[model samples]
Target: MTFTDDLKKENEDIFQMIFDHPFVQGIGKGELPKEAVEHYIKADFEFLNAFIQVYSLALSKSVNREDMAYFHEQIQFTLYDEVKPHLNFSEYIGVRFEDLQGHPLPPSGDHYIKHMLYHANMGTLAETLGALLPCPWTYLEIGQKLINKYQPTKEHPFYKWMHFYAESGKETEEMRKRLDVLAANSPVDEQNRIKDAFRKSCQLELAFWEMSLTCETWSGELAVIK
Candidate 1:
């Protein structure tokens, strides 16, 4: 099996937990509250903004033309295409995507971005992919699972959201293939770090869904601090 396949096999338990989460289940069933869905739009907007920043930083760090091009493509896709579903969803719900910009992510959302930025700032390109790959992988997996269970049509409330993720993206495929190649070429020690990073990212992806579903935010002094 490929390296990504191995990572998924080992992370299967986390994947199951994510699938079992009420937030994910509700999305699949189209039973989520608009408040919850709106919360997701705002958080994800902030999340992907951070994503573009990471890719921009990565692009700067790339030593080779190929790597630079890869990062550039990722940035473009994220800005223009990856966010399309969010925009579409917001419109369907009468929320302006522009209005959601600059909204602060809940703690877990910030933590997830900080996790990736830590790798992006401190690690090699291959190590950084470990942190980045799971975002797409987990979302694609969630989409596929929901599609299989619900067989959602265009009439589905979240058909666009579900279809967008379920269909995955070129960047997702590129990330997996690039990581596999990097893993094949890297030493054993680096491979372990990659595995650890991938696992942590998967766990964070699960947390993000829960955060969105519950509209979780800081409370008391912590809430006031922001």
Candidate 2:
């Protein structure tokens, strides 16, 4: 089995928890609260902005022309295809792009992005890829499962989001191939670091879902006085 496969096998329990999480189940059932979804959009926008920088860092670290081109293409996709639709959706849900841009990152989202950036900037390309893998990989996994069980209609709130990852587009395949190549070339000692990054990223993914589900924020204004 490849490192990706091994990582998945090792974290099967977390994967199951993520799939069964209320946030994911709500998407499948088309019953996720708009407020919760809005909160997620805000936090996700922050993550995406940071993710673009991670991609830039990856591009800088790439030695192969093919890898460079691939990272460039992904950056374009994230900026144009991925983020644009989310921005439009946010507007549809009565959220202005400026507001989302101005919103502070929640603790979970902040930690996840920081982790990705740290590895992307300081670690090897393999580790960067490992840190980056869980977002798309897990989404694709959940998207396929949800799409299989739920045939979303036009009115379904998450239909577009579901389809985005469910289709497993060219970009997703490119990412998987890049990860495979990195894993194959990496030394046995480095493989452990890559796997560690992958596992932690998966854990962060779950935290992100929890953050969205609970609409966690940094504000202390709502604290109750004893």
Best by TM-score: 1
Name the lDDT of candidate 2: 0.82
* Alpha carbon lDDT at 127, candidate 2: 94
Candidate lDDT (C-alpha), each: 0.85, 0.82
Error of 1 at 61 (Å): 2.9
C-alpha lDDT of residue 88 in model 1: 60
lDDT of 2 by residue, 172-200 (tens): 66776778878898898889999888889
Task: Kindly give the stretch of ten consecutive residues in candidate 2 with the minimal lDDT sum.
Answer: 217-226
lDDT of 1 by residue, 89-130 (tens): 676667777776777889889999999998889887788999
Each candidate structure's count of clashing pairs: 0, 0
TM-score of each: 0.92, 0.91
